[model samples]
Target: MTTHVQLHDRLDYQSVMPLMEELKAITDDDLVIDAGNLRHLGTLPLQVILAAVKQRAARGQTTRLANASDGCVDMLSLFGFTPETLTQPEVWT
Candidate 1:
């Protein structure tokens, strides 16, 4: 089954740890991260998400980032990540 994790408005230092922990605990074969509410994106949370993606990739699982807000898109692009790349770990790696 697919599991969905909704991101909060802010992903700064104050919230990164909990986001990372939540992402790490998801053992679903497929993960759907809802970024529609994201208004800020921190490097730490980005790293956490990437790590989660890579780990899932190693297990032949898949992760998808969905409903990205404009802020989320801009933040990702600032880090040189396109929304398309999140679903394809190999593309980012």
Candidate 2:
């Protein structure tokens, strides 16, 4: 099953906890997307993604992000996380 989190606006500290809960509820291996709707992603938001990635890694699951705004891309690069940022996907669903 795929879990898609469409972040239409700001993705900051306020959004993380609720998203974590939603992600926790997901069963079976799946995908998560902070998709086309996302606009701004602050430092806390980037950290949130990092944390989620680590958590999923621990569980042997995978999470892929998509449609990151240019600002989001800049922020990821600013934080030195560009390598992990999902830009083009081999298979996007």
Candidate 3:
């Protein structure tokens, strides 16, 4: 009932749109995405993740970002994405 996405290497503008589209496939049952392998994550990549989170929120679904490297989390923080956004809300059920 759910899908998971892994953030591979080089999440720059060149790879973000497709990644975003692919991430859109994630359903509620999917949990703990592995993004630790990402080597070069940019602001676009952070936006992609944010978009996915917002999309899931809009649908009242749950999305989890798992194994995210500290660098990736820092990148997201730089783009104004709070760590709280990555957590699943228990009220959604």
Best candidate (score: lDDT): 1
Q: What is residue 29's positional error in candidate 3, in angstroms?
A: 4.3
The residue-by-residue lDDT of candidate 1 on 1-93, one tens digit each, is 999998998998888789888988998899999999999998888888898899999998989999999999999999999778976888867
* Candidate 3 off by > 4 Å: 28-31, 82-84, 87-93
Candidate 2: list runs displaced more than 4 Å.
Answer: 83-93
What TM-score, to 2 decimals, does candidate 1 have?
0.94
Give the alpha-carbon lDDT of every model. Answer: 0.89, 0.63, 0.67
* Alpha-carbon TM-score of each model against the true structure: 0.94, 0.71, 0.72
Worst ten in a row by lDDT for model 3: 84-93
Ranking by TM-score: 1, 3, 2
10 residues in a row with least lDDT, candidate 2? 84-93
Q: Candidate 3, residue 67: CA error in Å?
A: 0.7
lDDT of the structure predicted as candidate 1? 0.89
Per-residue lDDT tens digits for candidate 2, residues 1-93, read 777767657777788787667666766566667656565677766665666666676677777777666766676666655534542222211
> Per-residue alpha-carbon lDDT of model 3 for 1-93, expressed as tens digits?
767676786788888778877876566555456778765777777767766766677777777777777776776566555345555433322
Q: Which whole-number lDDT from 0 to 100 does residue 18 have in model 3?
A: 88
Per-residue error for 63 in candidate 3, Å, reads: 0.7
Better of 1 and 3 by lDDT: 1
